[model samples]
Target: MGSIEQPEPTVKIPIIDVSGYLAGDPKATAACAAELREACENQGFLQVIGHSVSEATQKKFLDAISRFFALPTEEKEKLSQSNSPCYRGYEKIGGQKLDELDTNATTDQKEGFSIRPERPLGKFLAGPNQWPEESVVPGFKEAYMEYFWAVHSLSKAMFQLMALSLGLDRTYFDAFAADPDGICLCRAHHYPPTPPDAAGRTRGVGAHTDFGALTLLLQDTVGGLEVLHKRTGTWHSVLPVEGAYVCNIGDLMQRWTNNRYRSTMHRVISPLSHTDRYSCAFFNDGALDMMIEALPGCVPEGEKPAYEPLKVEKHIVERYVQSYGAGGTYIEQRA
Candidate 1:
């Protein structure tokens, strides 16, 4: 009897300043919700910084997303994503396989544009947004809706500091994000520059695990972004931090925190820098019929509520029909 080794995961990626919970300051918002509840229960990723959303408005929304990915691939395939319907638009370069929900994953070379919620909710991946010709990217729709409403108001102040780090009531996710209807989305990625004989089976995004409930990313400093230290299975590097805003915790906020927060498993490792790697995620995922459950102060008495309720838009359209299938009908087929 002799074979045991697990023990490495410790790269320490927490930067959470949150400017005293955006200056409401109740003792710096309880020390920023105890450092965002120990960085969302250890490495579900974090790195927010005062979050005032200005580095010249995230460099004018990454310079209008590098002028809409330097147009002309037939004018960005005339806003592709197979002419939307709810897939939003533009996706070109290796047009997403995002490891098509993993089958030994590997297809993501990256190139995106997605967008949702331009108010008119009605549900099911909301709708409307495929813009590109504000006279051909001159202020690309007002610098991407002013950095998407300033990171959707810092993801509703990070869901009230993730409900005051779970002791609840920091407006406990404000009635599941009631607003002009929430189910936020807003991608922008680009990636490009990874072709030296395709760099070992490509990947500017692959690992996966972020089906919603907070994402916020912003990147652009040409990093690569990795993270998956599940107890030393190794893969860390999430470096870039100028005006920080990496934040993570997804999988519907780790099933409403019953597993006590953690949705890790990130990736995007192609950039060794030939100069090309913008980013802009957003996500959020609330109120698509919001039900989620599990948060009775994150169940503990007799321990038994790991996750079941779930309904946020049918678990985000059944993880987008198990990661992009159903061609383009993310739920609405019932016959």
Candidate 2:
């Protein structure tokens, strides 16, 4: 019986094919919506297949990411993350604040580039990215911009699912849409080879929850992301499947559901002795002025309030600055 590996304490984390719903078929849309409810309550994470983000667009992002990260340290360092009003840029290894989460614990060992949707110079999360000039990286600006638009569209679909899962009409959130600009951002990561963790250490990104709404993850080759099943206290490897985007709920979902949903802790752990990893996350941010209050249908009665009503933009930016060591100055422009 002990050989069962303790069941790994996993939450099923449903797999849904979105092609039907996206094709304007009512039957498929209903089926997809039902599955999203199951996933949100059980794991708050799932594998999205049949999503229309073509493999070609995925290849473009992958190719551009490979080329961008392959640049020399001198060239990449020019766009280091410290230059942004919101700290979005190239971040060196072990950079980034996970906030009050084990600050003295070992820092994650990796480097990445952060890109966000376009907005006025003063907007915190929607500002332009610090792309490598074409001269330096050939077609980086062109590629990254194209990649951004593609993921942005997918993020919108995920948002609609969130609204429906909360027992609200699919268009409920449309009223709170960000100014002509939302705060969706993307991060392209590169993790170099690392030795195995001793007994209790983690690699890549640390054990923490995402601070926004849904996260659409794209990975290439190697894998290291792990999700901690709160019910079982066991960690499970987040397996990779080709042609699918891995989706996970964030703190926003947890709050909206009054804690019925899980925004569980996830971290990156090293593989064997030698391996490299590449990953990207399209962070789905709600509108700047949206009120992040609990959903009536989620908690019912006799359930304790899990989170206070918060302005999503404020909570997200506040957490981002704190997690990395900044003194809470990422002032997001209100819509």
Candidate 3:
């Protein structure tokens, strides 16, 4: 007789309140770390509340992004990503194809702008960002940078929790992440309402796994994000909760943990509502030259590491080349 198939368990993404950790309470921090371990191992995703990023600040940054996206196509095109060697600046709707492995994949129906830490002109992915004139989008740069630092701080805190979860010293990951060469890409995405006829065909962003260490996402209430359940082969919607940032482990983290933590596949479906959707994703990867290898605590006795050590930046550059095709020339040249 054939073996029976058991149904997959219904999994809800965990919501963790990080206020105590932010306040430096040891017990609360450890408790949250335990919860985070379970969430990362089982679903690779969770929502973080009480992360200390102000609501007013979030609103200001999002408002500025909305205004920037509302500019004339010509003006927006002036900062096109194609013009940037290091992959910073504006990307128009239908400019990116996220699901490179899917033959039927279409260009994503979202517009976006990307920025990274400003550094000397010779550094790859570390040069100055292309911005709209102050007259074009008042307060855009200021608001965005403020939010960037807030999120960066939160990411560092999260790393501490992750270390505790893995039975390592709380600062185990800090050295790799502390360098100026650490690559943190901040992206603002705008998904316009899909027409009825196009709703069935297009995606705001195609199904893909993030390629970095961690992703912290702030999404507006127009919910369309979906995550794939590996065990069930089913898709689940991720509805946005007010004032919470959705957080997820990414490929690099999973590699570092020897797959003890997951990096699940996720995507953004086109919104059915007439209202637009806005989201900001901050991807925190460790330093460019940092070697990603399975942590000792994550490997069981007599088990081998699942992956070879990889240079963080090289891995990211390769993924970008696959995803962006011709637009990935800068990294390709470097390779």
Candidate 4:
């Protein structure tokens, strides 16, 4: 009899400790930045520890999301993302197709809710979030909003590290980070258990690069995320790291670094276990109008920029439209 095949072990994404950097220690900050440079250049994914977001805070936010996803279909549909012009609300399973490059790709098998800062109306994907009534889930809104700001603060610190990693002043990316027009999106995703007959036709999320500058992800221990190793053309599982956020650069970052830093492809498979999986992803895409071009130190001495400069929002909107179709259209037909 032939032996049974075993699943590949989870790959070890580089881990970095940044507590000292957060405390304004120049030496620790420099060391942290150096490690960041290596991870960005090679794997484009890393685990961040010592970020100081308490486990209680993380649990509160995730618990809120789990409660929201546990609602009945009819109740959830009332806050459907389709009703919002900016696409900020509950997204039903299969609402997005991330692997658009694949001719045979099917819709993703996940449900989610997206939230952005409650900015004034009149901007693309900017406006009030769709929240469930406090009666239904007391403190749900508060929990998520608190986490949003916490992660936002961490993202600014990350941008500073990224700038330093490129051999530029740590403040080189500050303007972009502080721009009010920057898009900071947070999402709660729930991947239900895979059907027995799914047969690999669906994914929790498909293989694709993120559309923004950086992504900070918090995932549960069920573990289905995988990253594509560009060098070897193989996929490896990304196991959960306790008390750490899994961070990765996105396409815009790749553009800014002239591809010196990679934007690796990643995807999630539906968990085969009876248990469900959940994740929270925060995307820190810089200012809408910021130009994406090679940074001063990112380009080689004689090589021209590999990518033409493009506005951050334009690139993001195009990618959203491609994935979300009419659901991704801007409110009031305004770009």
The candidate that achieves the highest lDDT relative to the unseen native structure: 4
lDDT of 1 by residue, 246-333 (tens): 9888888888888789788887767444678888888877777778878776787887897778788777777776555522223342
Task: Work out how many backbone clashes candidate 4 has.
Answer: 0
Per-model TM-score, in order, reads: 0.32, 0.88, 0.93, 0.94
Task: Supply candidate 3's per-residue lDDT for 18.
Answer: 95
lDDT of 1: 0.76
Q: Residues 233-259, candidate 4: write the lDDT tens digits.
A: 677888898778999999999998888
Better of 1 and 3 by TM-score: 3
Local accuracy by lDDT, each model: 0.76, 0.74, 0.83, 0.84
lDDT of 2 at 299: 65
* Residue pair clashes in candidate 3: none
Model 2 stretches astray by more than 4 angstroms: 1-12, 99-104, 176-179, 195-202, 301-305, 326-335
Candidate 3 residues 1-335, lDDT tens each? 11112223435879999999889998999899999999998889899998989999899999999999999999999998878777788998877777633556677779999988877555447667888999999999999999988888888888888999999999998876556777788999999987776525357787789999889999999887888887776778887998799999999999999999989898887645678999999988878878999997888899888998898877887788777763233333353
Each candidate: RMSD? 19.7, 4.3, 4.5, 3.3
The segments of candidate 3 whose C-alpha lies over 4 angstroms from its true place after superposition are 1-11, 199-201, 326-332
Clashes of each: 0, 3, 0, 0
How far does residue 328 in candidate 3 sit from its true spot (Å)?
9.1
Q: What value does the lDDT take at residue 308 in candidate 2? A: 80
Task: List candidate 1 segments past 4 Å from native.
Answer: 1-17, 20-31, 34-49, 52-57, 64-66, 73-186, 189-213, 217-249, 259-279, 282-297, 308-323, 327-335
> Stretches of candidate 4 above 4 Å error?
1-8, 200-202, 326-333
